[model samples]
Target chain A: MFNPPTELLPTATNQSGTRTAAVPSVGGRTGIARILLSRDTVMIYALVAFVIYAALFIPRFASPVSTGFLLLDVIPALLIALPMTLVIITGEIDLSVASIAGLTSALMGVLWGAGLDIGPVLIISLIAGVLAGAFNGLLVAVLGLPSLAVTIGTLALFRGLALVVIGDNAVANFPPALTSFFTSKIGGTGIPTVMIGVILVAIIFGVVLHLTPFGRGLFALGYSKEAAIFVGIKVVRAKFWLYVASGSVSALAGIYWTLRYSSARSDNASGLELTVIAAVLLGGVSIFGGKGAIPGAIAGVLLIGTINFTLRLGRISDVVLIIVTGTLLIASVVAPSIFEGVTKWLHARRHRRTLPQASASGATRATASGVQERK
Target chain B: MTLDTSPPATSETTTRRANGFAAVLRLREIPVTLALIALVTLTYMANPLFLSQQGVKDLLLNATIVIILSVGQAMVIVTRNVDLSIGSILGIVAFSTGTLFVTFPGIPIVLVFLAGMALGALLGSINGCLVTVAKVPSLVITLGTLYIYRGLNNAWAGGTQYFAGDRPDSFGALSVDTIAGFPVITLIAIVVVIIVAIFMASTRPGRDLYAIGSDPEAAKLFGIPVTRRVLLAFLSNGVLAGLAGVLYASRFNSVGATTGTGLEFDIIAAAVVGGVAIFGGSGTVIGAAIGALLLTTITSALTAIRVDKFWQQAIVGLLILAAIVIDRIARIRTAKKLRLSEARDV
Candidate 1:
């Protein structure tokens, strides 16, 4: 009875926003529905448009070789985003993913430097990542600390531990075969072998998020924790394991990053969280949670990658790149609501023009500010 | 999780007693002060020079900028917002201050500071305007600004760095000049802290800030000027960060694009460690200042004892976690106690 209602609940009764009718079951969207009028259709079309534009304008940009390199550049962020989408979908964020990747990379370096074999090093690093995620989960899901506060601390803690394990030193002497395999292209193709890992992970994440009961449960949980609880969803356990999954994926990404770069450094992938979050949010994943798809996030990732590539080709300064990213991130957040508002205004205008008397005008206009006023 | 900031039942003797003790524990910086003393004592036992006059000055000098920034940062956080762009602001102001000295060799010392503060307030106002108008979470807005400002700093620097020799020695001496063995800059930080502390403690707007943080909807219903206050908080934080930037130029004797890169996290760590609740509605500038001192001292002590520098960051991280966990535990106990009291009344 003392429990405050704002947290982990269906917010339908409590806030000023359009409430989505809860998806009733594990029935994933069919192709036609998925492609048409979905929230992320904008991102999907933009990605396609960007690809088309780049193909026509930029030299060799449409080639498979450029795609391979682009994927490699974005691989670390893309890998982390797979799980991040789930976490964000569940109404939580994992800011420590980059730090976990760094820590895993550091662990690999320190262990390898001590002459440990690569196999054990990889295993241990992945385990450490899972443990880190578990710790965050325990705090947030069980102890019920705010994830924002908890993850901010853990971000530092994980990064600090990475520094402690390998202080300011870069280990670049990973076994040549591993580095070669990590960076190597497929036979006579522009595709990198790393695509295998990414594709495999993406397929798994896609199926799990869209086609499975657990995936439906994630959506339910995000839409409303209290509702999910009432529906017998294990809210705490789902949140706990989501973090664990995030951690493990990050660790795998770290191993990939270490091999891909042929170096292990404490600061590897620093500031990566922002880019991944930008991608996720850009993909039409609601920052407010419970509405997103992996395909959209992928498209978002590719759009950012294409933009980065085209800008680089234009010889734009790296500083300009960061500014573009910041701008795009901000625009992605603000533009959607503005679009909704304009459409609503237009609809209202059309309605007013058609009808002489506007009955129920108050009810129609009451939701005008709802999109902007989340609180 | 509810983030409801309704006050406890004051009529119950048990609740009142518990609250009084908790307030005393929280209001006084006793825990942090005691921790600082213990850490220093232990470190001194290992290395006496750490407590030596020069060592003490070094600690104070290192902590001054962080302390000033923490005071400002605490205010922003207390209002359920954060300014991640602070480090960037510091970098910009520091570099700008250095450029001012180079550009106008005859410029008065105070004018440089004023110029830097004006630049900072302008940046802060931009942040304020975007946050208030857009209604985006401060995290997203400031995160965007963090990179934007840093990018601006980088673009401005364009691989150039300003050295101490570029400035008048009088400007450099501002950091070193001692008043009764205390650095002038440190004194300035203390004064800023005291003033902000007083303002937060005694002013209506200041109290309103806590109310807004605790439960913003209620604060709005109560007719608190949420937008203006939040805007002011960001602006004020910007001003302090600018002050810190000016000090950074003096103390570090060099200004570069990377002057304050990644320091926002460190400042946040200091505030969280010092017991400023990240979720808002609690903590003090004094506690935050002491937190800055403690964190800086820990670094100095660890360096003095020849421990790994990485441990310092980890320890700060741990302190952040500890503070949150302690807060969680306290909330749980208070909740249980409140429930028990309700049961007894029934």
Candidate 2:
């Protein structure tokens, strides 16, 4: 119903039936118009509107300590989402990230409980996380299996291994040395140390995704793997490393979760894969791949976190919170098509209106003069 | 992103080769069956009690819910979609069914089953409408509904649990009453499996599902009512999950908010292991049922042999990886053959 505007994408496909059209670039003629019409622009407006409304309406919504907790609460999802954005950008996904996070938490608890020194224990868990990610890379990249199915399998497998290590037992009372730094606020600014970590990761991921050759390869792959290959991109290697990156970052998030909470359990961050995904999509990352930004995703994550914090503060039932999340997830995805449809309909209405005028003015004059004044 | 090796040709075109159908059959479920047998044999040899009557009952009982859920899941997967909300649906229906039993205290057990299924169908239809009409991927839509439905369950049944003690003996006995040697619940699961398998293999719409899953654009071009077929697959899956919910109340004797939480993973694992490709097309519901059986038995065997129960999950993870790898190899070979044939024609 909403075919992309053909004029902007002529020769978008070649003889091999590959999609050669890139995401609409925000440069050159009518660049300002393109920016105004894009999803990211819409998201920025929504994020600002939401923050202002929440601050005014909700008691203490804009307070410093609350902001710190909000940032801390969203760190794992925020961190994992960076790599997830890349994974999705390449038109693939890593469903095993949350499970890997949970596994890391379980491992951290078990290794520490086994009386291993905390330093070595932490290192081992992180390595296990990397290996787990590499295994996914092997299947999806090297072996060419569907990431969804393979990750679903690993999702269960990793979660189960978590239970194997911890069973129903939970480990609390972690050492101050391990938990203190990540949890402590930075220079009395009410910003948790983890916020700094997230900001650093976001900066690195943002640069890699938007500026580097590897980044273009990712966008190209999302456009079409065959086209990317034809263009001489190392399609397989790029995808593999992204998956591994997703895994390691997810594990790092797991470590943060355990230390911040000062408790580790097999089910740490259970069902959180959905939350991370929702945040990514809400951030305006196209679920179909390609067409998204880390900054937009960051805003999306903050919006959801702010909503949750507000709901909790208002003492709204958890049920309401869940419904709001689902509604937002559905709306975020469904809204874009509806937005495109409306624009198309409006364009058609104007086209018909202008057609009559063109007939009156003579076609050549209408085409050149009338349109020339539009911009 | 699934870059399927085999060309998305019509089934007839693909299966016309002398060894094609045979290759498919060999690849689909034989490996899972062999693995089940081998694990059983090895586990039984180590602990004879594994094959003992009590052990057998535990294994069958543990597997029945997942088997039922997997059959439903395979249908959705064949449509290149998934229903993550089924677990939450089961939890909701199971709790409601438990409430029904307690409130009425004299309702027919059959009626309760119907009520539970209808409730599940209603929830499932929401997923269908969203995926079909919204055109959002089922994974995203269902993931959303998974939490929404679970949230509803929590809100409705907060801290309230229904125990078998509250139900009549006749109701709970339904799970245990045996026909020949099989548990009544297990018999029901087998019947459902057989019926679904037959329908999928024999019906026109069933074949249409395969066509749609194989290639959506091709199926649409063939005039297959793609949207309707996909909706039907989702609706049926919901009904089956609902049925699983009723059985959960019957067997487990306790229904609560957590009754079927996180169960979608196990169901999906079974379906995948049984050889259902997640990208849609290929594989059977019966294979999924067997996959459920194998996974449950693996869990049983690991526990029986005194291995860490944790390792059981890891092995299943390994099995899932192996199954996909094997399927991928077969696909590559088939794709190569097809390519060669296409070259000959050119």
Clashing residue pairs, candidate 1?
none
Model 1's TM-score against the true structure: 0.90
**Candidate 2 residue runs with Cα over 4 Å from true position:** A1-29, A114-118, A165-169, A348-375, B1-27, B339-346
Error of 1 at A120 (Å): 2.0
Which docking category, incorrect, acceptable, medium or high, applies to candidate 2? acceptable
| Cα lDDT, model 2, residue A325 | 79
In candidate 1, residue A322 scores what lDDT?
A: 69
| Cα lDDT of model 1 by residue, A1-375, tens digit | 111212212343223332221111112366687567675777889889988988898887888778888888988888999999999988888888999999999999999999999999999999999999999999889888878778878888999999999999999999999899998999877788988989999999999999999999998788778878999999999999999999999998899999999899999988787788888877877665787999989888888888988788767777677677677777876665456446546655665688546444543334333322433
How does candidate 1 score on lDDT? 0.82
lDDT, residue B302, model 1 = 95
Q: Candidate 1 at residue B29, lDDT? A: 60
Q: Which candidate leads in TM-score?
A: 1
Task: Quantify all predictions' global Cα lDDT against the true fold.
Answer: 0.82, 0.82
Cα lDDT tens digits, model 1, B53-114, are 89989999999999999999999998888888899999999999989988888899999999
